[model samples]
Target: MPEIGAPHKVTHQDGGNDEISLTGLSGLAGESQTPLAHKTSHQDGGTDEISVGGLAGRQIFVPYNAKIADINEADTNKHTLNLETALSETRKIIALIAMTSRVSGSSVFWVYPNEGTTGIDLVATLRYGSTLIIKDATQRLQYSQGFANDDWDLYCFGYVVEI
Candidate 1:
């Protein structure tokens, strides 16, 4: 369970079913790849190229859209996250990250929209400085209807891991 007032990484795999461990923190998610954005050093130490990686000391903003209606009896979008196995079609993006103390776990979580539903919106933003392993364009690890078939959009920003 996520600590009150603390942001937690919610893990969802397999499908919208078969929930797994609700406790324990692990390592980062996704496969390792070349740094998408990295910081460069200068000789005079004046200014340098800055790269962004996973959530370690960086902030990532991912926008998306989901035409889902709020539910009454466990029908709210919150239920979409209840599925530990995988997020539902409603969840457009899943922000995966490395193990950290803030969330007490290593996994992926939902990035909800801050404004009205059914339009382009900022899904989630990762606030950490770690190497971005990989990002998925699909909706969680389930029998997704596919991007071409669904009404969702993915905006991922991969930064270089600050050494």
Candidate 2:
């Protein structure tokens, strides 16, 4: 009887919601020792959705007080990525890659921050070479570009939860 906008299916019972597909998976969760993050429990009725495309590439480890936002250099283009640590509480975006060793077909999207100015409605268009991953139901991955100058070095691994 449902089917309004569709796209909602979460089945669980085997270890119940241990973070491994509730919908949105591009394919990848290769190895695990329990650290995929995205554990929700409702038990009987339903409402336990998990995303970040099933940990994309896997490696969800964040907890050492986490406070490291980086971009090595060369942000040439219509650049827009600034996160020198601004997640004092919402942590779980495992890892956002692209350190640029050789591949430079750069492309990234997702933005929401204004005061220093930033916002024109553009979201989630990542997934390029050099393994760009994001997991643990994701937290925040602020970025924006349109490909004009081409030069990047991004890094936004996360962990800052205590509440």
Candidate 3:
């Protein structure tokens, strides 16, 4: 009978045992050499760094929201949404939610990573309230609608890494 919230010694059938604690678990293969810890320093006024699960980096998420009204109906041209005003630096897009007002008669929306006619299409669909998990890095995004007079709302949750 082991105590709750205490380190328990786990025995293996092969006559091996390892101590597992409530805070952390061991016995995993190819684990990181660095221990899980958080350090704060005020000498140089730097950000805090945390090492968890064998990964070390500064974890920061910035919420981004942009709304475009009356997107010039569905045309052959694409509209650009500049994120410089919302986010100062270029960030990795972790997750993005694209929402559009309800429209009738088969409407589709496309989100691109670059401007102009040539670039990778990040999203393309006719459904509203769609979520996309992307790893593309950029400061701006381009969008186009299938129907005329459709409003688009973009919500982005991005992660910024400090060099």
Whichever of 1 and 2 has more lDDT, that candidate is: 2
Q: What would the per-residue lDDT of candidate 2 be over residues 35-82, giving only the tens digit for each residue?
A: 433443343334464344545354454433332333333452333443
Residue 24 C-alpha lDDT in model 2: 48
Q: How many backbone clashes does candidate 2 have?
A: 0
Best-matching candidate per TM-score: 3
lDDT (CA) for every model shown? 0.29, 0.38, 0.47
lDDT of 1 by residue, 33-150 (tens): 3554333234334356443443454434433233222212211132222222222323334343221112122222333322213321122333332222222343321111112222
Question: Where does candidate 3 clash, by residue pair?
Answer: 73-148
Question: Runs in model 2 with CA error above 4 Å?
Answer: 1-102, 105-138, 148-153
Q: Estimate each model's TM-score.
A: 0.19, 0.20, 0.39
Provide the clash count, candidate 3. Answer: 1
Clashing pairs in 2: none
